[model samples]
Target: MSTSDDDYYSDGIDIRDLPKVSLHDHLDGGLRPQTIIELGEQIGLDLPATEAEDLADWFVDSCSAGNLPDYLKTFDLSIAVMQSEQGLRRVAREFVEDLVDDGVVYGEIRWAPEQHLQGGLSLDQTVVAVQAGIDEAIDDAVRDGRDIRIGQLVTAMRHADRGLEIAELAVRHRDRGVVGFDIAGAEAGFPPSRQRAAFDYLASEYFPVTVHAGEADGLDSIRGALFDGRALRLGHGVRIAEDITIERSDDENVYVSLGRLAQWVKDREIVLELSPSSNLQTGAIERWGDEMDDHPFDLLYQLGFRVTVNVDNRTMSATTLTRELGLLGDAFGYDLRDLESFQLNAAASAFLPLEEREELSERISAGFEAADNEGA
Candidate 1:
C-alpha cells in the first residue's frame, strides 16, 4: 500500500489514476478549507477555526459526533460563505478541480439552492452561478490536459416546505446544467411523502429523482423514498440492510433473506450511494457495528446489490472519492476487479442519458484496463 498527498495505492497502483464517477458528493460538504476562510472573512462570519488545516480538522471532529444532525452542523459554515454568487462560483469551480485531482471523469454535485438565497440571489440565479463555476472548471481542466464532466443535482431541504418550488427550480434549469432532483437534510421526521407534490410534479415531467434515505432512518423511510418520491437512486441507503436477514449454513455459507423492501430494491437494481466512512462517522451503520469492517457495504456488494462507493462529505470526512475506494478496498479485501466493478456500477447509475452513461462506462473500462496493464 502507498499513500501520497492526493492518491492511495494498492499493489503499486495509484487509485487516483483510475477513472471515477461521483454521484453522492455534496457541494457544501466538499469545500476547500482556504476557500472557506477567505469567504468567511469577507462575510465576517466567525468560523470554528481560522487556519485552513485547523478548520479542516474541525470539520472532521465536529462531524464525528456519531449522529446525522451533528454531522450536518459542519455545513453551516460552508453554506454561510456560499450565499454570494461569487462565493458559489468559486467553490463550485474549485470543487471540480479537486475532483480532477481525484481522477473523477464524471460527477454529480448536489446542493440545495434555497439555502443560498440569503445573498438576495433568486433560485434560478443560484443555479446559474453554480453552473458558471462548473463550466469554468471544466474548461480549465480540459486546458490543463484533464477531462471531466459534471452536472448539478438540485437538492431541496426535506425539512423545509419548499420542495415543489425547488423541484421547479431544478426542472427549469435541466437544459442548462442540472441533471436531477434530490431531497436532502433531516431525513428522520420529514419523509419524502412530505414532498409528494414535488415528486408528483417531477414524475409528470419525467425528471430523474434521487432521495436521501436510509441514513438517518430505516426501512420505512426507504419505502417512502421509493413509493412517494419514486427515487431512481438512494443517497446513503446504507440502512437498507435493516430489511435483510442473514443466517449461517452448516457449510459456513451465509444465507440471506431479503424483506420485501430490500427485495424490491435489489430486483429493481436501485443504486445505493454507500459512503463507508461517512456512514460510520454518522452512526448510519451502528445497527451493524461501529467500524469500517462492520459496514454493510461488503454484504450488499456480495449480495449483488447496486452498491457504489462515495465520499458523502469530503471535508467532513477528510477524504476524496479515491480515498473512499482505498478505505473500502482495505476493509473488504477488494482488488482492482472489485474497484472497477464499483466504478461501472456508478457509471450505470448516473442520471445521464443512456448514450452518455454508455460513454461513461466505456471510459471507465478503458481507464481500468490501462491501469491494470501499467501495473502488470
Candidate 2:
C-alpha cells in the first residue's frame, strides 16, 4: 500500500494504470523541472537551481512549509518561466503529457491567464497558445494509441481586481478549450463576494465555476463561494470538516453532526476537489492532524460527501494521482472499490456535458473493472 519511486499499487492493483480525472490541477504548478530550466535559460531568468533534479528538490522543499501562503511562494519560479507564448505552449503540452503518464484520462488544468500576460501576450492570446498546445498533445496521445482529453479552467487570482475580465475571457474561449471559470490564489481576506461582478456575469452566461475555499479560510469563505460566486465545486474544501462536530464516541460508533454549511454541501452533492498531499503541505488540515491519517477525507467520504482525489501541484508535491491514491489507501486501508468510487465521483463532477460525463464514467468503470479482474 506504500508508494515508492518504482511502484504505486493498492489492493494488488497498479494505481498508475487506473483511469483518473483531475479536477483541481494547476497549470503553473505542474511543470517539469527540466522544462523550467530550459525555459528559464531562454528567458534569461535566474533560477534557484540550474540542475533539474536539484530544482525539483528545491520546489518540494520550499513548498513543504505548513502554511498556504508560504507553500504558494514557490510558484513565482514556475510562473516566471511561463510568460511568453512559447513557454505557455510548451508547458501546457507537457502538462497534458505528464497527466497521461499518471493515468489521467480527463484533466481540467487551471491557471490564471492574467498572471501569464507579463510577456505582452493578451489574455485571449495566452489562452489560444495554451489551447494549441493542448490540441497538439491530444493528437500525439491519439497517435500513440492513448485516448486522453483535456479542458482548460481559466482562473482569476482572488486578490486581484480582474475577476470580471477573467470571467469574460474564460467564456470567450469556451468553444476553444476553456470549459470553466475559477477563482484561486490567497483565499483568506478576499472572499468570492469581492468578485460578485464576475460571478454574476458567469451566471448570466451559464458558465461552470469552481472556487478555492475552505483551504486557507473557514466556513464563511466557503459560504461566499457558494452564494456569491455560485461555485459548483470547491477547490480543496478540506476545511469544511471544521463545521462537522463529533457529538459522542462509543466503542462501536462515533456519533457526529454536521453544521448548516456542511449539511448544505453534503445535501447538494457539491464536489470537493480534495488534494491530500497539497492539503497537508499547506496546513489546510492542521486542526485535525499533521499526518495523512489526520485528513478529513475519510470522514467526509464515509459521511457521503462527493470527494475526489487530486494532485493540486504535481511538481510542488512531487506526487501523481496514482501516488495520492496510494497514500490515501495506506492511510485509510482502502481497497480497489474505494479507489473506484473516487474516480466515479470525479467523473460525475466533470464540467463536460452530461453525455460526455456519462461516457467518462463508463471509461473509468471499465478500467477499474479490468484491474479488479486482474487482481482476482
Candidate 3:
C-alpha cells in the first residue's frame, strides 16, 4: 500500500502528536507541491506536473527508481525553483511549518547551498535567505501557540570541489541559524575523503560533522566518514549492518558478531540517521530485500547503535516522522515504549549543547509520559 501524509497510530495512540526530533531531514527534498507549482510558474521552468496534487504524485512515482542516481534526479526540478532568495525563503518557511504540523519540537534542516545560486544569489545570501524564512516561521508558529526550534546543516556535495567553500560558509553562519556541516550526494565514487580538506577545516574549528555514508556505499565509505571526515553521525548508515554477521540463531534468541568497523560505531554510539522508506526507494537495502522489513534499521537499533529515525525526504517518500515510525512499528511490532526509545535516541543525538540536549530529553520523556497516561 502507498504511504500517505495521513495520521498513523499503533495501539490507539496517534504518533503525530508525539514530540520528535528530526536529524536527517533535507531542505530541498521537502518542498510543498503547491509551492513548487507556483515557484515553477514564476521561474518559467517546465515541471513534470502543473497541479499540486499531480505534482506530488509525480515526485513519488519518479523517485521510486530503486537507485541513488535516479532518486537524485528528482532534485533537479526542486533545486531549479530554489535558485532565488525568495524561493529559498518560502521553501524554508514552509518546511518549518510542515515540521511543526508533524510534531517536531526540534529539527535540523540540511541542504547544499552551492546548488541554489543559479539566480545570481551568493552562497552566503542563500544561507541568509533560508535563515530568514526559518526565523519567520518560528515566530509565526509561536504566535499560533506551537513552539519549535530549528537548525541548519549546510551540506557540501560530494561530487563537487566546493567543500572547503561550503564548509567556510557553514562556519561563517555558525552563530546564525546554521548548526553543523554535512557532505551529501552520490557517495560511491565521491567519498568523504574527496572533501578531506573541508573536514580538516571543520575539525580544527571544533564543528560537528555528519557524512552521507553507508546509504549508497558500504563499509569503506562509512570508515571514511568516521576516520577521515570525523563524522559524529552517519546519514542513513543503514549499510553498516553489512559488517555484522549473525553467527547463529535459535527459536528464542539470535547470536551475532560485529566486524571491527561496526563494533567501533556501536561502542562509540555514533548516530545512524536511518530513513526507512527512502532506503527502500533508493535500493539502499536491496541487498536484504525490496521491502521495508528488510531494512537494517531494526538490526542496528537492536544492537545498541545510536539509531534515530528520520524522514530524509518527506515529499519524495510521501512520509513524515510519524509515518516512518508507524511503518517501523507495524513492520517490527513496536509499541509505545519502543517508539519512545527512538525519540529519546534522536533527542540525545541532536546537534545541540549538553544542557540543551538534556532539556530535550526531559521534554521527550514528559511528552511520552503524558501520552502513556492519556492512553491509560
Candidate 1 Cα lDDT to native: 0.94
Task: Tell me, by TM-score, which candidate is best.
Answer: 2
Model 2: CA > 4 A from native? none
* Clashes per candidate, residues 3 or more apart or on different chains: 0, 0, 0
Candidate 1: lDDT of 122?
Answer: 94
- lDDT of candidate 3 over 1-376, digit per residue (tens): 1134486786677889889999999999999999999999997989878888899999999989899999999999999999988999999999999999999999999999999988999999999999999999999999999999999999999998899999999999999999999999999999898999999999999999999999999999999999999999999999999999999999988789999999999999999999999999999999999987888888887888999999999999989999999999878888888889999999998889989999999999999899889978
| Residue 261, candidate 1: alpha-carbon lDDT | 92
Q: Backbone clash tally for model 1?
A: 0
Give one digit per residue, the lDDT tens place, for model 2 in 344-363: 99999999999999999999
Residue 202 of candidate 1: its Cα lDDT? 100
Model 3 lDDT, residue 326, Cα: 90
Question: Residue 360 of candidate 2: its Cα lDDT?
Answer: 99
Clashing pairs in 1: none
TM-score of each: 0.98, 0.99, 0.98
lDDT of 3 at 230: 99
Q: Residue 14 of model 1: what lDDT? A: 92
By lDDT, is 1 or 3 better? 1
Task: Name the lDDT value of residue 54 in candidate 1.
Answer: 96
